[model samples]
Target: MTLKPLADRVVVKMVESEETTKSGIVLPGSAKEKPQMAEVIAVGPGTVVDGKEVKMEVKVGDKVIISKYAGTEVKFDGQEYTILKQSDILAIVE
Candidate 1:
């Protein structure tokens, strides 16, 4: 199954990030704050809202940083994904 976003929404999957200490001990990703980094899975086409055009800045395969508390989480095909609006995406990671 695939998630296709609509109306300026975006679907993304969280990218696991790990931290390493100076001693070479790697800490698990679960121990950190809410994961804000994710990979763009699907993108919605630009839409018109309230007489304004809302364009999507992120595209599929793009790495982005989203708001910690934004979006809805969905589990599909045993994988987790977040569906959020384009405005919730803070920045795109180059």
Candidate 2:
């Protein structure tokens, strides 16, 4: 199934975090921090939200950094995803 966000919402899939540190120490899954980076899966059209004009700056396939603890988690067809408002996205990775 495909996801289509509406009104400045965004759908993203988390990118896997590295298993080892730069020092070559392998970290277990329980020790890994939650990944804050994700790839844009879908974007909503620009819309007026909270009495302000909100525009979507990211598009599908864009890599983005989001605020920690932001967005709602979802599971679809054995895959996980996050749905958040465009404002919750911190930056678009170049």
The backbone clash count of each candidate, in order, is 0, 0
Name the runs in model 2 displaced over 4 angstroms: 19-22, 26-30
lDDT (10s digit) by residue, model 2, range 2-72: 88888889999998765777999988655778888899999988799679898788989999999998989
User: Per-residue alpha-carbon lDDT of model 1 for 1-94, expressed as tens digits?
Assistant: 6888889999999999998999999989988888889999999887898999998888899999999979999999999899999999999999
- Whole-model Cα lDDT of every candidate shown, in order: 0.92, 0.89
Task: Give residue 7's lDDT in candidate 1 (0 to 100).
Answer: 93
Question: What are the C-alpha RMSDs, in order, of all predicted structures?
Answer: 1.7, 2.0
TM-score, prediction 1: 0.89
The CA lDDT at 39 in model 2 is: 98
Off by over 4 Å in 1: 21-25
Query: Judged by TM-score, which candidate is best?
Result: 1
